[model samples]
Target chain A: MIRFVLACLVACGMLGSVSVCHYMLTRSPVTEPPTSIQPTLRSESALQTPHRTPDQQADTTVSPSRIQLQNNDAARRFFLILTSGFNTAPDPFALGSDGLTEPTRLSAQYGDKSIITLLNDLLRGESIRSSEFDVADTDITRGTLTLFIRATPAETDARIPCPLRIDLIRADGFPCDTYTLWTPGNGVMLTGEATLNPVPGSNTAALGWELVK
Target chain B: MIFRNIYWIFWLHLLLNSMIPCSSARAEPLFTVVASTTQIADLAREIAGDRCRVISILGPGINPHGYMPVPNDGKTVASADLCLQNGLHLEGKNWMATLVRDNGNRPIITCSDGIIPLHLDYDGTVVDDPHAWFDPRNAAIYVNNILKGLIVMDPEGASQYTARASLYLNQLRVLDAWITEQFHQIPPEKRILVTSHDAFNYFAARFGLTVRSPVGWSTGAEIGGGMTPERRRHVVASIREGQVPAVFVETTVNPKIIEQIAQEAGVRIGGHLYSDAMGPAGSAGERYIGMMRENTLTIVEALSR
Candidate 1:
């Protein structure tokens, strides 16, 4: 009878241990907490910048009503023809500063490195000091550049704009200056010399006296 | 006995973790994604690879500027889990917006959202022109963004998408190098490139081609409004003074204007260039590389001659 009572006491102890283990397992700490970031609330000033928002300035940066210049088949054709047929000689104003003296410094803006090189070559051909020609600005909205040329009182704009001609280098690498007139009035005859020379470091140019009209 | 219990518990925990659907549920989807244009569609296909069924509505020779999506096209976009577009108002806003409205749940990824677009001169006014695909480098970013979307949709396929994207990026690198090499064939002085539309500003800027065009970039605008007679006269004068020998035509745009210009200026129409879309399957311009190679060769041959 004494042995039986001892066995019961041991059984009670074992049950107590099991209950403790169950409680420990059930109350285990979280293994994996969230790794996500907590969003911070922003102040009103933080949300609003002093500068004008794009939406607010949308009206000032209005898009052209007619965006595609190529949609007009006739106009496109004429543009191609004019590009191909027009003489591409360097504008005499591009050579001289004020139509009275040859430019000693020149700057051209064209994104294309090749066009920049071509412009440089053309300038060198005009006997403009090679050091005078440098790429002032090369990034335009498109491929066109607003170039500036400065003369150092070396040569006079002796020839009028009519006598001055610009020779253009074609995309195909051919020299183009004049083409057969396809329109009325012998299209684009130079009556007298016209000049176009930009101020130093500015896009604004002095319109050389040219009589294209 | 206590040690044995502890070991048993660890084993049971591992077993449960392995048997659960943790990996399978996270597996990404693999559907072929088709696009409307090769520029964007090609990018999507590059990102999707074996995971998606990629197809384009506008194949080689097709033009997105004037593409008329058919009934099947709407169905295709509507059913897809995700649809991709070039969205700078590229695919006429009307049709694209309608498609988006129809497929409310499906995500329509715009590839050109962050790109700096080229502005064109339209009647002395500046506007954003939406032909961003001409530059292959910009296309690389487009493909990357597509991969982002694909990964979100199918996390399991993220690795596959990444692999395919890298391969496509390598191809674009080769394309860029090839364009530079091809432009080298023409004498530096003869590298003046003029097209029927202002679609080539990006190409010209990237490849060092001097371009002149009467038309600005987008084809969605009115034809006669910006292209005034005065501009035509100026262009004619430029042609007479400039010695441009040949002009180019885009595959999708009507070549009538180019032809008229050629006739008037006595210059040859170089050839049709693939600007907006690739050729149909089994054609020379069906794939991205094929289309770009064809363009390079056309420009080279035309200008080199």
Candidate 2:
């Protein structure tokens, strides 16, 4: 009789604990939007700065910084084209045998922590590859847009120099050349819409951004 | 007797807990949006995210220009929280508008609202072009209009809609950039787009390409519009004069005209571009972006060589 009473109580206790834990875990979903790309009607300054200093960019665990321009109302859209050594990853601006743009291929060819790796990471971010947009051209121009580009150091060991040329194109259509980036703590940031020239920022040797236009 | 009842209830609680755990049963979506065309349907789906359900009255490759609502289409919109249509007379003879009107005064939103329309001379009267989604920037406007309608219907999902709209807008920007870059390969002299009708004006204007189509194309009141001898002559002249290496057939338009033009012009048929509707399911042009991507690829390959 005593054992039967204890078993019932034990069983009841276990059920209660399971319910409480489940409630706690399920109720608190990750509802907050990532801080980098929150939409708001702000001054152009927000698009102008993106953790240029190394200390400000030490944490690479979160998503790369994505700055939105002007009340999240964008009249023109832009895409970045990367001209690197990887043949499989076709330059978006170039014509190849096939009609498809080969996706980015990332190997430790530069020891995952190098600038090239960081570039690949930025290009492969969710924002770069997401397919939820069905945008059309607009005639009503929004105010001047402050371009924000964030470059963070990827965790890699290889320090080999990778020469790369980068160009920027907006949806309205145009291109520019020449670029420069200041280095801090082995991290580099590129801003502006039309062109990008990367000056070596960290330990990687011979890493340069060429004018590819 | 009371003790026996207590034991039964305890086991029942355990059984119920095992099945449901901590999550409550999910309710039906916040609301349902019914769009007249697949393109607008996709826009609503993009903005709605997982918050609500979106249904398109017409299926893939069904020309919106002359879509006649079936029996089920009426039932489909009957349960809709909101109705959407591509205004500017894309819905041949106002078929979609008439359908929505009979749906009992639902909050109908013209997805093409706020677009600075591209007007074409139709029957001696200038009318706005209906195929505005071709431009990535205009696509942004369409998405925003849909977002606003959704927000009005379900205020609580405004942030969700806005956030999604931002992501989608960014994507549009990327697409626009990519399309421009792809077109850069074609020499300026060869940057001409020849299609069955005037559906690609916004796209060509947005990018650095020129579009040439037959006269009375802007007023194509029927799908795969009947080709007149004069219109046929215009198409052949456009191809020969523009030195267009290849012309494209349309998924929704009658390909017979394009095929005859391609043969008459002595140019190879490049490929069929998705204009009035996206490709059938499982095809490259299944989604809006997919359609654009495939269309650009087709155009690039045909024109570059």
Candidate 3:
């Protein structure tokens, strides 16, 4: 009888202790749980400091549109940009400094790593560059051309009365014989459109864009 | 008698503690997933994301065309909480089905369920090619099915699986776009892909290229797949006519036939490509993405000349 009573008491104590321990363990809050992927949320300063490369600094600011240019030719080419509607001296709601208010700096997520920056005359802000970036060529035999506008979420002007014309001409100036790129009046702020054209006899195709309001 | 009862109680404590929810409870039934091939296994692992254990029957470079299952394979299949198979006759003699049916009939998820299969001539009979994963877009389908499978097996992990699947799907999308750009570098006439078997049909169709192979879809006889004299001669003529710069060999299939064809056509053997199986572990082609990337680079390097 004595042994039976002791055994029952011990069993009861064991069960109660286990239940409490389990409850505490499961109830405790985990400060940092184990996970395979931890999303890194870094600040702009960490990536866009002046010490960083020109590409890194340029990427911190948002922009209107970005175009990727690649060529197989030995000679380097430059983009010939024609402009009219930035409206430097327009009515109120005129763009800041450049008649382009709500300025932005955009970049493409994929493509070649080395970026081609705009010339000195096109840039204004020390870090936030101009919308008129350059389209330079390389000797590398990259066969595709890419154009990415800040489309999808919201449409900005470039934001008010955006630049009317931006064309990529191989020659020094607007050579009518050469094909060119276009910018619409709605501005480069929404849905992205891409088309591929086969270059006759050669592997490269000159990028052409259509102008729309 | 009293001391003996205390000893018994001590063991009971340890036993009950073991039953608590913790990592050491592995002896208990787990969310275990089984795959028939390494490619599907890799996809399952990516989608599972540490939530479950994934086991693959076929190791690196093991041909699924003529697999002979061992006794241990039965045990592995029996223990699975879920089974993943690359359906459409990817397994030889439908062995995976037999193993699962005999073992326990665990819920099987067909990874190729949603893909629009490409039909090819296997021993002169048109059959659905089981190499759809060669295209990253098709791989996204595999990922979705696995995502659904994992969620069904462990509903608690649905959010984690969905997040992982979303990220992985994005990676696959990027991979597809990257492949398109890579193929664009080659001229229209030069965009010919030569492999050991008819494994590149989906890859070629997705990226706007032409595939030339001397061997049938598989290298096994039971599957009605083998190189024929007429096919070899035709392939040689095609290579010569196009002045094809290079041909490729597969990691899983025998390289002898491809070597002979290369010699006859006087074209250099373009570096090896991973077809039926990925490269051995620790190699660049070990994972699915790495395998695709390596194959693309090999073709680009060899044919661009």
Candidate 4:
């Protein structure tokens, strides 16, 4: 009787172990590690290097193939092309003291550094010029760069010097004997020899930046 | 033995059933479209409905003229099946369009196609005025171009696209008539408009208003300097000369400049106008029609005196 009871207890123990092993074998293998472990691993890797924001990464990792116009010659040519395109009496609502407003001085709105960066990016490659750049119907080839200027009282005249010289002619392609001259920086000086044509249906004129060298 | 075999078959059937959903999920197809501006994306969505996925490169308040394309924008373009842009150089140096072309040479549709483009002649050079959609009739042309492009890309949905486009076009015609009637209330002499920039030339031409601004055709061109003394004197003189009852600010431009001019001229600041971009999602100018209506109402209220 004692031997039979012992045998029965051993058999039951073996069956329980076999059932547990079978269940374990049939269970699914985890495709992903536990969520708790992922954060710890990420933290460990993150500690190995400094974190970089997306913009910083973009600024640093600009592709080598991407063309940039960093030279003074390119910058000067770009400024001339940009300045030549302004319409005489461009803004209909705002008339100059002469009853015609030439293009607003660029140096007054943007800093030299900001303007240089924008021109460098836009005029980086030869193919870039074929692309049209327009704003509010005015075609421009550059991007916006924000920089601080000497702030003055709203009513007072804060005449910041213009960056480039521009010349304007009449719609009939005649010399209006009107021109604007200014020297912004980098030893760049414009003769204001360029002429502007009237944009049809608008009081403003259009500058052909593509025709500029 | 028979009972054990039956139990094994039942488990096998359960496992096979569980795999069906996973297979179907992987089989679903997606048609991806890339649009250059939010207005284009909205139009694409109206036409595509749930049949395709649409993404806009320029979001609300982003000036398409001065927009710079990043590396991620190129990646997005590479994954797109079709691309759309408001052509005639509306992309500000055509940067957005060029970026798309450079990425994959994917099929790009210019929504401004087939419209009689307004040209601006500066000196001897003639350039196309790209802001044609300010007029509802031009907006119809945009829809037609978009419809044709969609049909060419996905002929399977031609009938659906055609139906949606027809409905939208009818609504545009109605919107155009409504604009005409709204402007009729304002006297012809009172139709003089002064705003932040020259974006309203097409709008003014369509509605019979004389438009003026201190800034050039583009706000991007205003970069050389802030308000010059000459420009300020010019605008203030024009306002006084025209006896322009009010001056308006644009939603996309800085109002400070216009405000200063209005203050100097002693005229009330008219309500904000939407140019280059539409208003936020819940605003009155959210949709194309809504934007036109809001703009017309604002103009009439300010100038109707």
| Best of the candidates, lDDT | 3
Taking the tens digit of each residue's C-alpha lDDT, what string does model 4 give over B1-305?
65556555555655565455456444333578899987788778777766678888877767776788988899988888889999877787787778787999888999887667777653355767788888776776677777777888899988888788766765775676578768888889889899987678888998799887876556675222335578779889989998999989998888888998899899998899988888888998777888889999999999986
lDDT of 1 at B72: 81
lDDT of 3 by residue, A65-179 (tens): 2122233231233332333233222111111111122222322211343222222222211222123223333211221234442211112233333432323334323221112
- The TM-scores of all predictions, comma-separated, are 0.51, 0.58, 0.58, 0.53
Residue-level lDDT of model 3, residues B1-305, one tens digit each, is 77787767667776767487575434443589999999999988888876788999999999998898999999999999999999889898888988999899989988888678999866569888999899776787788778877888899988888888877765775576577668878988998988888889989998777999998877787665578798889999999999899999999988999999999999999899999888898999989999999999999888889
Going through the candidates in order, what is the number of backbone clashes in each? 63, 18, 12, 31
Which whole-number lDDT from 0 to 100 does residue A162 have in model 4?
39
Error of 2 at A183 (Å): 17
Better of 2 and 3 by lDDT: 3
Give i-RMS (Å) per prediction: 22.0, 12.5, 16.3, 22.1
Order of candidate numbers by DockQ, starting with the best:
2, 3, 1, 4
How big is the positional error of residue B258 in model 1, measured in Å on the Cα after superposition?
A: 0.2
The superposed Cα distance between candidate 1 and the true structure at residue B302, in angstroms, equals 1.1
- Report the backbone clash tally of model 3: 12
Model 1, runs deviating above 4 Å: A1-213, B1-29, B32-34, B222-227
Candidate 4: stretches off by over 4 Å = A1-213, B1-29, B121-125, B222-231
What C-alpha lDDT values do all the predictions have?
Answer: 0.53, 0.62, 0.65, 0.59
- In order of TM-score, best first, we have 2, 3, 4, 1
TM-score of chain A of each: 0.18, 0.27, 0.25, 0.19
Deviation in Å, model 3, residue B5 alpha carbon:
28
